[model samples]
Target: MADSNDSQPGAPVPCAACRGTGQVISNLGGSPSQVPCPWCEGSGTQIPGHDAQAARRAAAA
Candidate 1:
């Protein structure tokens, strides 16, 4: 297994939920479907500890 925190400090990190693919697989009844990640919105980059809401709040402040 590789380290999750491989990016440099202050750099935007790849999304963990999608592994930077910007998409995720949902298994239902053994069938897998691809859907855009709620985080990163298909761009596949995220702030270290920031979610969408928090990012928005920070931007607003």
Candidate 2:
């Protein structure tokens, strides 16, 4: 059985960190600012073996 969530091989998947926006909100110093998504490196696509949670933590820092 194939899962619908599975994407075709080599297809670009929307980044989990940026939600395809290629950016993330950083609330550093109590101000919300937009920064390039660390997970996708601003490409808005998921990289194989990329850790979304680690990127999220880095973005929040």
Candidate 3:
């Protein structure tokens, strides 16, 4: 069966920072090395067409 996420006709692209893994390395000098990326909110993806800047502006508005 097709994956539900893949089945979406217009699913957002995988997040560049997290590369769709939904987590990034935290350089805060503590344990719990991985943290959810603020960009994709752990979803690990941005809107299909909008770049990161656009997405941020959109969110601000």
Alpha-carbon RMSD, each predicted model: 8.6, 5.4, 6.1
**TM-score computed on alpha carbons, candidate 3:** 0.53
**lDDT (0-100) at residue 18 of candidate 2?**
86
For model 3, the stretches where C-alpha displacement exceeds 4 angstroms are 1-10, 30-32, 47-61
> Compared with the true structure, what per-residue lDDT tens digits does model 1 show for residues 1-61?
8787686677877898899998978685699999776577777886455576765466569
Candidate 2 versus truth, CA RMSD in Å, comes to: 5.4
TM-score computed on alpha carbons, candidate 1:
0.52
- List lDDT for all candidates, in order: 0.74, 0.86, 0.72
Q: Provide the lDDT at 18 for model 3.
A: 88
TM-score of 2: 0.67
Per-residue alpha-carbon lDDT of candidate 2 for residues 1-61, written as tens digits (9 for 90 to 100) = 7687776778888998789999999897899999888889899988889876886687579
Candidate 3 weakest ten by summed lDDT: 47-56
Best by lDDT: 2
Clashing pairs in 1: none
Evaluated against the true structure, the overall lDDT of model 3 is 0.72
Q: Which pairs clash inside model 2?
A: none
